[model samples]
Target: MRHRLYVPTAAAACLLLAIPASAAQPTPGAPGIGDSYYPTYGNGGYDVSHYDLRLKYQPEDDGLEGTATITATAKQDLSRFNLDFALDVDSVLVGGKKAGFAKTGDHELEITPSSALASGRSFTVVVRYRGTPSAVEASGFTGWLRTPDGGVAANEPESAWWWFPSNDHPLDKATYDVSVAVPDGTQAISNGTLQSSSSKLGWTRYNWRSSKPQATYLATLAVGRFDITTDTTADGLPVINAYSKDLGANDGAARASVERSIEVADWLGEVFGPYPFDALGGYVPNVPTGYALETQTRPFYSPRQFANGSNVSVVVHELAHQWYGDSVSLKDWRDIWVNEGFARYAQWLWSEKEGEGTAQELADYVYSQHPADDPFWTVKPGDPGPENQFHGAVYDRGAVALQALRNEVGDKDFFAILKQWPTQHRYGNASVADFRKFAEQVSGKRLTELFDTWLFTPSKPSALSARQAAVGTVKAPERPRSWKKIRATDSVHAHRH
Candidate 1:
């Protein structure tokens, strides 16, 4: 519940401008954040604090006109900086003045400011672009999905460049004010709370604001004919659910699925501390992305998956991610189990709460389901390869690992570790190493062997049995057929290896 907020002072800004760069003069910022899996995704030497994105969509041409104004503070003296962008750029302006820009490398938009930026100096860069927006293809699905009337922006990992210019990495968290204009009959929705909506001439614009520091991957923009419903949670947080009207007879069912997200959101607050944001909601689109993403306050869901009676548990998974993945993000792709494992465990916990099964029983099922030489057991959930980032090992096996830790440390320490992990690094970046250290610190127990056996080792071990023995015996309840479907469909269960 505690937050480390940074507020700029007038004196600080004045002092920063008065200072000068080193004798060598300013230099260009690094083109990437040095991530092991994605070294060229995010730029370094500057910290983005806010993004003001204005977009207008023309249905006639399927073209999107956009202007992005990014506010950031220089971490070092910089003559130039890079923004991850992949669109037809009209112009680039630095600090309200025209600046020279060029496209270099894969997705970098390098811009040289008119004047050198001193360390700690606050500055803004505006980029104007227009093009027929296209989604970045990956793993057989596109990040920014196109719809019948308009499109939905759900870029995970490294696809934000397909629509907007940004840092485009999970480590660089920034607040957002996204305004989108569409035709009078359509709707525009994004993250956070709806600030206002207005009509001018023949276009209607909806403005949204996410004041919390959010990673760019969680940023989203949905424009189309949607059934927008406004409500509030029991805790007073705003609820904004948007369902695609393309469902026709199933539109009501889709809307109900999104409304059910509030129940999961409310329950997640009780389990995983506060909700961590000012709002909670869901965006249901007809485009079947085959997966559900925890996109900030409003997660996007495929109509086929969400309205099929298994909505609550999956909603719980994504809402739990609001605390795990959104608030405390991963430092590298290898640490993705920290995001996925926590969510998978949340699914187990919710199912146990509903009397479907106990967390231990479910963990036991997944652990025993695979054969001794199965490749699923060979793939380390914590250190899966890039192609297998979302492998079942990362989910089912990851949950088994957490349950094993719980068995070793007892429920009191395990739940405490859960709450403390996110609260300690709220709205910040963390890694598997960070989680290991923090787990040991909070539980007052050394977890080196546990992590080694579960995360680093390629072969399955007897740890699951040892932990089960330590926890005593339990009856395995009958799992619902829906869970079987979850394992059957690639949406929830797919082994990459």
Candidate 2:
């Protein structure tokens, strides 16, 4: 889990003075309004306004039964309503009445409303399902147990079978309140703050409130016997309530980074604005996978990597996502840079603060690694297959794009724009073009070519020297540059195409 970190001493002072006193206002009457630049079938043709989920786990059968009450707001009056859901659901109900729904695939569901839902109106639909879930290979959507000797294993992609009906795409977001009834002693965790929990009728009911909008894939539920530790940040926000069954083994190292996590949060708030969630925490599950997930308020970490410091970067990366991916979501998969790029950039910013390297040094290192022919926004402007959207092309290359912009606009203005972005578009969505216009407006520079070259085109811009010059003094170190060789790996299964 060892990784590189960079820190910049002088850049912080320079960045504070770079921005102008006055902020630029967005232009009025722009076409394709909202965060996304491209046209979208709003709510993906189905409006999931709210969800009430009740799930009961049966460890004896190694399965669960979920009953969901979905309330949708219709934009158009139609005779038929379609809902997407993972395979394994048994039945559905519309307005408290049974309705026919057929499973089209492992990742899709088709349902006809018991009655037509008029435009500008809302209706409720419920689904009852049961299945033995299978976890996707290496994906965090896994359910498993640990051996007595402390080895980890799982059944992943379980959302396909164990969970309630869902669109299962990042673009389709909705509000959910989940209540899971697990065996008496086991704990259950999900997105957002916990509302209430109690034992009733031989089971424990864990109710969670996710007031913020969230994509279905980011939704999670963990049920196991875990030791819980809770603390709050200096700012009074819940610091970390990390959980693990093997407390003595990994807790010490994981706890050691808690303050660092808060420090990073405080630093980011100074640069990017306030932390987005009401609470921020991480979970170290006893799992074999080496990857992590940014699941809204709570992120999941692999216990196997908990002892290694390299996993702390995963914390930085995922926390950055709270502002980038969670707050201002991407409308389509192709615009995933809106998620990964900003998160990756935040990691670099953290490095700069940690005295790992100057921001310029890190930027230079990233630029040196990118292929000359690859652009940050090369993914097609549509639903570019999932595989094409989440790789280093989006993460590393996208961070490089922001670094280039920082170089061009200077750090002060660059951070102002970055801080302003989430505040203005919080809980909404955004695309690359929308971001470009916003950046241009904030910096008072018409950067169409810069945008086109780094994002839309197929190559890195040749004006790197000029761009660096615009940002003020940045001395490129002559030391051997191996940090640039640390390319992001395409090994995470959840990110697979």
Candidate 3:
């Protein structure tokens, strides 16, 4: 049985009345968004536009010196602000002048600008620090880890603070210009297109620019002795695939996976609309990290993950995330299923396309593999606990939610949702509530029960039964359904603004 929801049109108007109108003096912005899972994840009252990160890393002793210059706009009258930074700070400057700063509660760098920043005013904060970078250990994994030769910064969730300071939340997406000076023998790589590299005085400085808007977590740097391979896609998009020199015999397999990433990018662009970023590539560093992450333009893979061979399925999964997780970010950490779920469904779609099995069969296999009493279902996919953000429920059950929605709506509408969802919210933040509204608006069918059963509820969703009830009872409103393909010619990158 599907539940019906009635959303009142005046809900926003009602909420606004609760806020008292006053010409109050400037005060500090809230330290956090009050996320249920990670309360102090992101700051309040301002939005970041760009991050200029300049870092000097010495791999011999793992010493790091960095200065992060953040440009942002104040969303409200504010006397003070906060940046999520875990590293040691030596000095702080606001708008090019010295500003008073002190390390506050967990990961918060409180700064008082030389003058109070008025509402809508833009400002810049620069922090210089030196330290041996540490990792945030959570969910039995660390965010940043050091390799035998160099280090890899994969700051997923909230680990970006460990390396550099910024608005660490996903909602505050910003363009990045990351320049790192490393030892002459080693190489440094981060997100976005390569800008320039110069070696002088026994140091090599590699500069990478992410012109597209990127969440801080998806911004990455891989520093090591690398076997660099650069090429171009059939469409002339530059590709740079870096493999760790430590992958002795596995270099061939790792390189093949990189080459295959180009093919998968083309295929996915055709099906999921155009590729979201300027370039496509990946890195296979033998870092001890047990998982692979979809870090914007260049995904990172651990050599251990491809032990069997070139795992094209993993390649497909991560590349799909370039469109899902990297481009269309989540509004809150609780909405992580928005990333994992979409990537899992994309893998299933690729499998179906390759004649392996239909998405239906894969969904059935996943559902049947776990009993209803398993912890996977106990944690809600949409709002899992902080420690359980990557629970199986978010991945498997999340995909099941999309499959159920597809079943309720036909194939045509389902594919349309996939393409439209990313296109509309490209390089921006969205929540489960936001997604629900968008799905309802696009499919013209009420999806209250469908999202409730698979996302918020603890019980395993019976896809066939629930979708059957939905399609049999509900009548979707008629609206003109059109698929508009957004090519590079039709759209401009959000960072351009």
Candidate 4:
């Protein structure tokens, strides 16, 4: 049945037509999301809420083919938009209608919907793609790691581009459901919980779900033969630890450290706040990348992190990031201090608990070792350029700054700032300035002078302030040998951030 509306009169029709219409007009979305350091890292004009990926892999050829269904809401009316991806696309569909698509630049896929997408309209983008991720490189490196049996998708700042299309930045966090089909006899591990696994006709499909919002850099998955372990925290959150069967001599140390995932996460909760995610675990993949990454609930560890022996300090560093780096992420790459500083400080705290050294002792010792004229003082952790984003000063000096703050505000306020910072910004992004304001608000003290001396100034402070020197001054006796585990230069390469 059809209903008809009557225009009562020509005057009335004219009056209705005279009313204003919506102001929005379709325009091409920005090609980049405006990061000063890495401008082209993410796209603008839309926010992804979730991703549902269906993928299949051939380990023998390192080939991957997949269809990605991205759910997002347009922030502005748009005729076209971009996604950060590096793959061979076969077809694209916007809201079930065929859409035009083209590959642009090195890692961007520009898409044109059949019609303009109105502001605030929820839409679905389905992209069909296939490629050998190991062969694809952007920004002069490949995030995909090909192993003897299978491959691992794990890297910092940018990894999803090689394995899955995404709004590839910490600023655009979204939940994910990744389903990968691989040949039988191999296990696929990913972030969050394993939803389902089924095998049929010599192929196994493993579906993993990340119920919490996760940054694109922190989302990871690996498919290979593993010695998998399962446990639960006191809070009953599931813990899944996996180590490649071929770890050789490092196997014992890897398990010894990663096995403490449950213990370490719980300790971090008491020091920071309640664990932010629903799951807890770590994996030691047999890759030579030397650095371990805090990848959401399941942190990834390179075998070399344990080459010397058991390294629970590195474990503490990565798990602390579950709060500092993973739960409350960086608003921009320049806020590297907010992540590395807090994580390194946690290592110092762990040292105190293990009878190694107090945070103040560790801070003073580090300060005493670096001379006033040393170039180390020239690198400001708060604004170290892109080239020095992961420089050792960002980690060591960053933590030193925290100890200075603790002394300035006293223990009560400093601990409160630590626990509250993550609670206030849980599952979101924050800048170092935002953190300073929060600290000042919580401690009721002006921190600009302190932050300036430690974070902003490109040179070391004239000397540790009286508050910073309360722990017997920088000329204290030799620190215990165990201090090695408390510093970022501990040979573990925790500076991989």
TM-score of each: 0.90, 0.79, 0.87, 0.94
Cα displacement (Å) at residue 227, model 1? 0.9
Query: What is the lDDT of every predicted structure here?
Result: 0.81, 0.63, 0.79, 0.88
- Going through the candidates in the order shown, the clash numbers are 0, 16, 0, 0
Best by TM-score: 4
Better of 2 and 3 by TM-score: 3
Candidate 4: residue 340 lDDT (0-100): 92
Encode model 3's per-residue lDDT on 1-497: one tens digit a residue: 99998664697769767776444588897888666777787788899999999999988878889988989999888889888877789999988989889888757889888877788889888899877764443334445678888888875675587788888788889999999999999999888889999999999999999999998888898899998889888888889999999896667767777779888998888777889888779998877554778888999887755655565767777898888888998877888888888887777787777766667766666666676677777888889877778766677788878888888888888888888888999988888998889888988999998888889998765544454446552432222111010011011111110
TM-score ranking, best first: 4, 1, 3, 2
- Tens-digit lDDT track of model 1 for 1-497: 99998877999988877785465578899999888777888999899999999999876556789999999999999999999977779899988999999988657899998998888999999999977765333334445677777887775676577678998788889999999998898888899999999999989999999999999989988888887788898878899888888865556656655678788877777778877899889888777556777889998777766444445666777788999999999988778988999998898888777777778878777776776789988888878877778877888888888998898889898998888788899999999889999889888999999998888888877648574568753654355533653453337422121
RMSD (CA, angstroms), candidate 3 = 10.2
Tell me how many residue pairs clash in candidate 3.
0
lDDT of 2 by residue, 96-116 (tens): 777777754334456666666
Question: Which candidate number has the best lDDT?
Answer: 4
Give the per-residue Cα lDDT of candidate 2 at 491: 30
Model 3 poorest ten-residue lDDT run: 482-491
In candidate 2, stretches whose alpha carbon ends up further than 4 angstroms from where it belongs are: 1-44, 59-61, 135-162, 247-251, 304-307, 370-385, 467-497
